[model samples]
Target: MKQAVVIGGGVVGCHIALELAERRYEVFLLERHSRLGMDTSTRNSGVLHAGIYYPADSLKARLCVEGNRLSREFFDRTGVQYRPSGKFIIARDRSEISEIEALRDKAIANGAEGISLVPQDTVQKRVPCVRCVGALHSASTCIIDTGDYLTTLKTLLMQRDVHLLYECPALAIDGGVRVETPRGSVDADIVINAAGLYADEVARMTGLDDFTVVPLKGDYYCTTALPLEVPVYPPPNHGHGTLGVHLTPTCGPDVIIGPSETPSRGKDNYDIETPFAVFDDSLRDMIPNYEAIRPSLREGFSGNRPRAFRGGTRCEDFIIMKQPDSVIHLLSIESPGLTSAPAIARFVVKMI
Candidate 1:
């Protein structure tokens, strides 16, 4: 049997391992944590992006559109819990209407399905609490049970007899064929580095150091105050790092808000450091009746985004690099990553 080793056990790593195993490769999945999806996978908003936010020709746009479809199909086949609750990207003022139009056009170019521009009155009738001049309704956007999804993927890999080593961190790599882990040295014909935050460090081990992973922290708050029917977002932050603070309906009763973008002190920093007032201001701008639920807000969770930077500029597209010696590295896969995990896995295996 062909031997393969995959580092990192997040959603992307797990999916890649599964795909390789299906192709008759002996796969060894390494995870630093005791379990999978403990880091960037399960944290933050679990919304399956509809490929609307990225540039038209970017890898993120193409992968996200394909991933959305593949993910929903996987969830349906495996009985994963997810709500096909659509999304509304609202324009707060006339100035932002142009932004919405641009996003709509980009969505069409990216081949995102079930997209349409809705008038303000239609939005208000469905979600009376939200205030907007216009909205881009995305019927394909869905909220997923992230924990369940991750668990399901792990189980599927296990059923295929893939070796899953937990708490086995990769300390070094030599010649792109052997990985030095704390437990022992693992040798394989092919090595895949899907280490989320430490992908740059992994790349450097193999003498490929062209980029760095900069960790950015985003904070979330949960509230039962808003009667929102679906996920709602403002226009993209443009050049900024986030998609702006907006409301998202979860699989549960609580609605989540405020993933305020801030410079992370470290990769493992998951504290709710940002004050509630910042979320309060952002919420007030999107939903005029936010004050009614201001008192109901509670400290939720925070997740770090492993943003990739090359030559001191933020890389907006996902980077999948293949070294000459049968080593593949997946770097800077942030938002839409969870949605695109399955498609990313298929792409990675095809590279071999």
Candidate 2:
């Protein structure tokens, strides 16, 4: 059996480890933190995206759709708690209606299922408090109990006897595929770098430094006032790095809003606050009864996205490639990464 070393213990890394273990590889999963899914995987929105927003030809578009299916199946088989609550992309005015239509066309091109444009009456009937001219309803979108899902993956990996080392950070790589850690070095036939925010640094340790990871911080706020049954989102920002601050109904009763995006100097910069005015503005723009719910909005946690840049230019697509040695790197896995984890694991397994 070939020895495999998978770095990072986020959803992507966990999935990759599980796949490798099933293939009978001597897998050892390494995580810098004491527990898994503590970073970008558990932070931000837990929505299982319908794969509507990405460009048709991108890896995100393809893997997200397939991963959605695989994730649902995995949840069902494993009895993981998830809700297929669906989603609505709202157009607040005439100017935004065209963008919604364009998104609908793109969803069709990307093979996203159960998507349709609903008129104002349907929008109002579905979500009375939401103010929008029209909306794109994606019935396939869902929300998962991310904690439960992560626990399930860890349990499965443990059952397979996969060596999971927590609090063991990879310091460097020597002799091509040998991984150096605080405890000692591990020689592996294949090395997979899935280190969320530190992926670029991990790749550099192996002499692959063509790209850099830029940390994009996003802050979310919680509110129970505008209790919608499904996720509500504005039309995506035209040229921005994020999907815009929006509302997402968790698998539980409480609703979340305002994951405002801002660039950060480093990965540890999660101290920023979500301004009340910004959260209020985002709510007022989407929800009709903003004043009534404005007081209920409370600050939530923040997360950093490992956005990849090559030659100082932002990379919109995921970078899943192999180096000259047997080092496979997954960089810039931001949004939809949670939804795309299963397919990405299969892709990497096939490559190996």
Highest lDDT: give the candidate number: 1
Clashing pairs in 1: none
Write down the lDDT that model 1 would get: 0.91
lDDT of 2 by residue, 217-254 (tens): 88888877776888889988776757888888887777
Q: What is the C-alpha RMSD of each candidate to the true structure, in Å?
A: 1.0, 1.1
Stretches off by above 4 angstroms in model 1 are none
What TM-score goes with each of the models? 0.98, 0.98
Per residue, candidate 1 scores C-alpha lDDT tens digits across 82-161 of 99999999999999999899999999999999999999998999889999999999999999999999889888998999
Worst 10 residues of 1 by lDDT: 237-246
